[model samples]
Target: MGKSKEKRLCKQVKHDVLEEDLDGYKKLVVNPTHLCVKCGRVCNDPGLLCEPEPID
Candidate 1:
């Protein structure tokens, strides 16, 4: 089994996620019921924290 990376608390990592940067995340963008697949951090209170940069 592969080892999982440790997750940083949202408060610890500085993010600059924009509203436009969350289209693929769908409702999860605003309603994160799970941790970010990449960052392993829970979604922000508003639930828009995405680890992957948004696609154009």
Candidate 2:
């Protein structure tokens, strides 16, 4: 079986933040518009999340 191709926002945050990629992380979070229903993470791009819903 093949693994899923999508990379969720929560995973990105863990990777970018832990790796000290503040700039990359900032671009993802700046002026956030969507919330990840599954992980409760927020990001500007809904496509980055596993289950994204509009934030307000």
Candidate 3:
């Protein structure tokens, strides 16, 4: 059998994922997700953290 990299990876939420899923995760800027797929440590009380940018 091949060495599976996801051997120890969890399939649940973990990190503070953004509300929206961008195409190719580009807008996200990186591989961001609401749930930490590795440890399943979800942000139960994730607050709305964002900056108000100029809407043009």
My TM-score estimates for the predictions, one after another, are 0.26, 0.72, 0.18
lDDT (10s digit) by residue, model 3, range 1-56: 24333422221112222322234124322333344433433322222112212222
lDDT of each: 0.41, 0.79, 0.28
Task: Identify the leading candidate in terms of TM-score.
Answer: 2
What are the per-model C-alpha RMSD values against the true structure? 11.7, 4.9, 13.4
The local lDDT score (0 to 100) that residue 39 gets in candidate 3 is: 40
Please, what are the lDDT tens digits per residue for candidate 2 over residues 1-56? 33334766688666656476677667888999999989998899898888899999
Candidate 2 segments whose C-alpha is farther than 4 A from its true place: 1-5
Report how far residue 37 has shifted in candidate 1, in Å: 0.6
For model 3, what is the error of residue 7's alpha carbon versus the real structure, in angstroms, after optimal superposition? 25
Question: Which regions of candidate 1 are displaced past 4 Å?
Answer: 1-12, 15-32, 44-47, 51-56
